[model samples]
Target chain A: MSERAAAGIRIERVVKIFGDVGITALNEVSLDIAPGEFVSILGPSGCGKSTLLRCVAGLDTPSKGQIVVGGVPVSAPPEHLGIVFQRDALLEWRSVIDNLLLPIEFRGGDSRAVRPHAKALLRMVGLEGFEDRYPSQLSGGMRQRVAICRALVDDPMLLLMDEPFGALDALTRDQLNIELQRLWLANRKTVLFVTHSITEAIFLADRVVVFSPRPGSIADVIHVDLPRPRKLAVRTSELFHGYAGRIRTLFEGMGLLKEDE
Target chain B: MNRQSLQGVAITTMTLIVFGLIWEAGVSYFGVKPIVLPPPSAILRELFSELPWYLGHAWFTLIVTLGGFALAVVIGVALAVLIVESKLLEKTIYTVIVGLNSVPKVAIAPLFVIWMGTGAEPKLAIAFLIAVFAIVIDTVLGLKSVPADILDLGRALRGSRSMMLWRIRFPCALPSLFAGMKVAISLALVGAIVGEFVSSQRGLGYVILSAQGTFDTARVFAAVFLLAILGMLLFAAIVRIERWALPWHASQKDYSPSA
Candidate 1:
């Protein structure tokens, strides 16, 4: 309810050194995400994209620089952040509805008041009838959908997702990619999506941020400049192919990827 | 699965009968002394003849075992939680518990009898001592088994420490807790019997000890049979409760007769 704090995220010159091991994960990585903008971070495995997102989520502290979420600097986990991992991370003991209702439960409010919202969110994710089912009974894609509903339960200003659909098979991953796009379009929540898949980044994001390997620094930022409500068919389009090619070429230049795949 | 369970019971019954027949024939053929090795029929005859007397002692044993087991669970879980929450407890209390677990529980039974008297109190004290370590160790293992991603999920939700402990760790620890409980329950029974053996006016262990003293070998066998039934019944109860409490665990899958 704080209007002035609604500005999305300002991550200024963040660096992360994993102490003890003496490995530098991120170095002076600065990026600003506008309110309601969808940005994809495409990086190789050790490029610190996950580390950067963790810093923004306040799960990890940057060795230097500042991360501001909704006009508040994050030293501890902020109340207005949603994070989804590659693993769905649903509690096996909880039913789907209860899992989705976790944020409300965590905040210690009357969670019953959020029941209707939970139902509506489940329906929006096409998981309406499965509310009573345990996570073990669900397919991987379905579990990830429930996880996304969980992340959105609090209607956070920013959703920091680290390969949310990375574990699914190719067909299921593509399906979730479209499902996620539709959800994001409706909610218009600012999102920082991380993935290694170039096509996924090109197809889903308004901008794609690339990174170099260990002691990861931002290598390039490419704006997709594509239209919204993107369909799977868009991957066949010239502009989508152009974006993917450019991203691949950038990876090649960093020597992280082979010249031809 | 239902058929498999039936088959398992049927096979067990057949095996017991076959083994009994072989034993009885061997003892009769050899003209063995009844005191040295009684026939299965003689043992069964003894068990049924003293059914009422055995039941009284069995009931006492059951009560003490359950009482001690319940205390072990409560104290063990609280200790495990403290160990998880505080580094001081983890370093000092956990290490101490690990060290205490190595001591022979039978040796401790006499000390409990001396301090608490030759009553259910001594038996329960001994039983709790026997069972607490497994429950604490297993529950702590379960509580800590959550994936890094799951812990991150808790952090991202801005979950308070209490919330994380209750909603996340406790439920996650249930399967391991039950496994520990299975081990603990059996050990608790052993402790109660050991305490009864040391010095007790009542219970099956007392009956067995007195029967052996008087050379009533058949009665001893009968008491031993009752103890076996008691152990199986308690174990089966835990298994049933585990299925009810944790329908999501793979072990609870209806496909196994062990279910």
Candidate 2:
């Protein structure tokens, strides 16, 4: 972990319940992420990993618990944090460049100043020639790239991704994972990613936090001592397998891992 | 213009001419009196001969149609926004609007004339009543139909309520609003003509009523033709505006059948 002073995210006893039913989505979940660290909250479907991310992003308030980001309590989404959703969620009417500039527009930033930065971010995300194209004209992977650029346009201190590449094909997802790692390295923004892929979590995260299903709670938090600038080749490495195996064991212990696979 | 569009225009003009010729031939062959069923050519001649007199009537009808259409758009959009913003109001007011919309607007035109007045006001009111409910229902559905993930994205971006409305909700609702506008435009035309038929000194509706009373079939045909043209023009205008405003919409793109 980087020796950054501030805590990126601090969650304490977070509990979320839908309606009057005491059936919990999240039960006494707590986690702490260091500044500039890339952490993945890994779990199967209905594990409330997404709910945890939403609570941290302040999109949904926890029924009971506290979440602090960058030394400030996150009751509502703050200007300094950026979020990338599973679907691109890009405005179909807007051009790729305009979509990238959306966060800046929301924050009341100088449009003229942000335009250049937005352009640069789009280029960085490998969408250089697609600036003027509308979202409908772009392929699914390209649209997601535009969304990533939009999230990073404001140069936010923290980035929250809820399965940002979950909908993409395996090839596209792998490519984006590499792109994302490069982005995280260059920006050094604190990132909390939610995903179901064990290999993905092992490949991308400094720490992989696993959760149990239903009334989801942290099953385990395993540190990945894998070296930086991870490439696709790293996936076949023994180190990658070791980390993936540990995560699988954790899921197996929670009765989440399928016996067949 | 493309070859297909040019060909389409040629075919449309040819079809109209053929229809007109057939009608003229049928009337003349049957030796139909001008008082009963005059030829299409006779109606055309009468239309051109009394152009200035009909222009005034056309203007009056246009005013009522346009005025009512404007009112419907404003009230419909505003009410849709209100309904979408509040569930209790939506449930209560939506039922009332639906009930009112179901009642034949023509039956209420005379009542409107009594309440408002015969001069343009009642006509406009009738048109407004006819068109507004469609706008409200379609626009409300459009506003509400925005994807939940998009809304969540807005929330995540910390967008203000006003920002969300102006930037996201309004634009998202535009296609649906245009759909409502198209339906309302047709209804507005019918409403204006009906209002004039119920009580009016001028307009195509008045002309048709007078022609029927005097047994002048050619004049009645002319008036009906003009009204059809007016309805087509108004509907076409709305479609053109929709194309101009929402060029990014998927439906606007000319996709190959194979693609």
Scored by lDDT, the top model is 1
| DockQ by candidate, in order | 0.50, 0.51
* CA lDDT, candidate 1, residue A191: 92
Tens digits of lDDT, candidate 2, A1-261:
222332378999999998777779999999999988899999999999999998988888999989988889988886567789999899987888888888888889887887877887777778887888777887788888888888777888888899999999999899899999988887888899999999888889999998899889998999998888988998898988888888888888887767874
Q: Write the per-residue lDDT of candidate 2 for residues B152-175, one digit (tens) a residue.
A: 888888888888988899899999
Q: Against the true structure, what is model 1's DockQ?
A: 0.50
**Candidate 2, CAPRI quality class derived from DockQ:** medium
In terms of DockQ, the best-performing candidate is 2
* Model 2 stretches astray by more than 4 angstroms: A1-7, A259-261, B25-36, B254-259
Chain B fold agreement for model 1, TM-score: 0.96
In order, candidate lDDTs are 0.88, 0.87
Could you tell me which 10 consecutive residues in candidate 1 chain B have the lowest summed lDDT? B250-259
Worst 10 residues of 1 chain A by lDDT: A1-10
Candidate 1 lDDT over residue span A69-124, tens digit each: 88889998888677899999999899898998888888886789878888888888
